[model samples]
Target: MRNNIAEMEFLYSQESIATQFSRDKFHQFLQEDMIFPLKGVRKKYSKNEIIIPEGEVTNEIYFIESGNVAATKDGENVINFYAENEIIGLTNLLLDSHSEYAFQVISNELFVTKYDKESIIEKVINTQEGYFYHYVHMQNQVSQMIEKEQLLRLPSEQRISLALLILGTKFGEETNDQDLIGFPKSISKGMIGQYTNLNPNTITNVLQKLQEEEIIYPARRAFYVDIFKLEIKLDQVLKK
Candidate 1:
């Protein structure tokens, strides 16, 4: 049983590492040398600013130059959070659908390069690197959607834990403690509940339990996470 647990940990770590590498590659493709030539307008957005409102038709694609954004449905349910180097609006444009969620700036400030749908499509078809980046971006989007679906099916505690893990992996910064990673405090309990489709009370309870366990703790304007401990907790839950 111990061996099986170890194996699962190894598998999860390997998958996490690979996913990180893919993310790095995607960002690498977004460098100035690649994007500067594109006919895109660089724009700055203030916190809480709406980039695309729900039900609007998305005729543009946005590449984050800096900062964070969130996609929320009905102005409440958080569908996803996007950080630097990530692309938004592509999914809706590709699917020929209206925006189902509002994309809003969650950071103090956001800088993004926006390109019209036709211009981006033309670039994708005309440039080898653009085509590759587009492919990778689409792949990552699908993977994220699938992961979110899987987490939502988990029991409340596990679902919230996994959600935090995902957010930490994406937005966390290295801390003085080697075992702890810190993510923005802007990601509140309410946002976590919305992200995981759980009640606010449930989010509060689970977070309190995690804090008690020392798996996650609050920092100054950030939350410090012990991912190793959290993964062990998840493994233990799975064993049950």
Candidate 2:
């Protein structure tokens, strides 16, 4: 396995060379024109901890360097957040382009980069790529979520099934001789409603219906959904 951060850090000098930026111009832009620092504090968040909340009026952005996260509200996991330099909180403020979900770390993670409100504005003014990259990610995120919302506009039963379909496609993993679908972290029922158009109560009702149909089971708080059967129902209904 690759050496983890702690071991790697101990192996290197504190003042050792910083990693080169992929494009030198971006680095130059950050160093001279941008107000953000060379290296901000590396924040550490444990599993299930909220890194940022939905609709909060703040321009702080984080570029993930390690660990996975999930976005949710009141307890249904909607989006699985990736690292790989993906950004958080780079979208517009006054416009309707703001964040629609809260991000929580799914495990202990080291988040490497950050930019507060003023620094973000300065960078946007100075570097087109800087602004453009964030805008593209924001646009992609919003569009995907909007498409998901549309898909879930079906009756509560179908919408609930579609949610499982998405979770299976992106985040499912097998366990204990079964093709188990597990949530990386829990998401709020209220958040699921925002995506599904069905209110939390409706969602709960649909969950109960699926449970009665033997399509899913609730373990403690998290629900284990049958992704294959859910997809079969979705395929049958979505075509209608």
lDDT of 2 at 105: 75
Off by over 4 Å in 1: 1-36, 93-97
Q: List the residue pairs that clash in candidate 2.
A: 74-188, 75-187, 75-188, 75-189, 76-187, 76-188, 77-187
**Model 2 off-target regions past 4 Å?**
1-37, 45-57, 64-86, 93-113, 117-132, 167-179
Predicted candidate 2 versus true structure: per-residue lDDT over 1-240, tens digit per residue: 123334434554433312322322333445563365444456777777777777655566676766667766554645544553556665563323446777877645545466565665566555544554344445467767786767755677777677666655565556563545764343445545655666788888887888898777777756676766777777887889
C-alpha lDDT (0 to 100) for residue 85 of candidate 2? 58
TM-score against truth, every candidate: 0.82, 0.57
Model 2, residue 20: C-alpha shift (Å): 17
Give the alpha carbon lDDT tens digit for every residue of 1-240 in model 1: 344435444555645534643544644544446553455789999999999999987788888988989999988899999998778876644635688889999889999888787666665566554554555556678899999999999999999999888998788888887768986666777888899999999998998899999999876766789988988898899779
Model 1 TM-score is: 0.82
Candidate 2, lDDT over the whole model: 0.59
